[model samples]
Target chain A: AQSVTQLDSQVPVFEEAPVELRCNYSSSVSVYLFWYVQYPNQGLQLLLKYLSGSTLVKGINGFEAEFNKSQTSFHLRKPSVHISDTAEYFCAVSDRTSTDKLIFGTGTRLQVFP
Target chain B: EAGVAQSPRYKIIEKRQSVAFWCNPISGHATLYWYQQILGQGPKLLIQFQNNGVVDDSQLPKDRFSAERLKGVDSTLKIQPAKLEDSAVYLCASSSLQGGEQYFGPGTRLTVT
Candidate 1:
């Protein structure tokens, strides 16, 4: 079985400050990792994904994540965030053998202050 | 392009009652999925469909939950004799291929009193 763990339940940051949401996964086989953002009353939007390329992956809204296989981590980072960046972020993992299923972490709530 | 669409944005039902939600996937999408998201928790996959055929439903509550995708485009999920634990946002998502980046719908919030 595959599982995702998000260490932080909530993260508070001021506008234009850097932010990092930590995520770790446990899987017996190779996996695909992804980050998704959900604003209030909206569905989740794909932030970025690590499929088969470089370790570094860039996503929308100026967010990026690095897939570290040794550490089993895919942490999302933003050099600078805006007020609008306040949202709930999720980390998901899909086993390469059974790609149809995705296991998501609890989620990290990013609260951006002025 | 339009994203995945779900109907009955909000639903309130009593325990022991039944409820249903609908979803219309993006045009040309070959895969559709249904997920359950509890408050403060990440979404959990309940079922998956591959063009009107069942692919994976291992996690779905077979006794109380039922879902179908007809014509390979639209799908419906129903819960009979709902329980308080079933009160959550039901999300619908679609993807062009299996294991691809999925586009999610706004989700239908279900509250069982």
Candidate 2:
């Protein structure tokens, strides 16, 4: 079985200020990690995924995340954020045993202030 | 490529009533999924279908919820005797290849009074 936990429920930051959203997971075996963003009144859109290779993965809109095995964390990072970045973000995990299904964390709301 | 499409973008019904939502997957996609998203929460998988066949439905509320992918193309989800707590957004997603990033539709937001 797999589960995800997004520690912060809401994160408020000023525009152009860097930010991080912490995500942790528990899986008996290897798992794939992903980050998704949803704007107000819209559906989720894939931001980035960790499948293999480099520990750091980058995605759309200057967003990136690092997959840390020892820490069991996949924290999303952004050097500079924009007002448009205000949205809800989710972290998800899927194990090698069942890649078809995903376990997602309760989302984190990002409020970027100008 | 075209994104997933869902009908009845918004629905309002009284308690004990029945409601249904529709979804059309992207062309040639072999996988379809239904998810429920309540206010202030991430979407939760309700059911999955592969080529018009059921793949996983562990989280589906079998007693009051049902879904079907008759033609392996578009799908429909139903909720009978809807309750106040049943108000939520029903999201439909599709993936061209299994285990890949899914494309989502605008979703049908249901409000039960």
Judging by DockQ against the true structure, name the best candidate: 1
lDDT, model 1, position A19: 98
Residues A1-114 of candidate 1: C-alpha lDDT, one tens digit per residue = 899999999999999999999999999999999999999989999999998889999999999999999999999999999999999999999988877688999999999999
lDDT score at residue B75, model 1, on the 0-100 scale: 97
lDDT of 2 by residue, B72-111 (tens): 9999999998999989999999999788779889889999
| Model 2 Cα RMSD, 1 decimal | 0.9
Cα lDDT, all candidates: 0.96, 0.93
Q: What local lDDT score does residue B112 receive in model 2, on the 0 to 100 scale?
A: 100
Task: Give the interface RMSD of candidate 2.
Answer: 1.1
What lDDT score is found at residue B73 in candidate 2?
Answer: 95
Chain A TM-scores for all candidates read 0.98, 0.98
lDDT of 1 at B87: 93
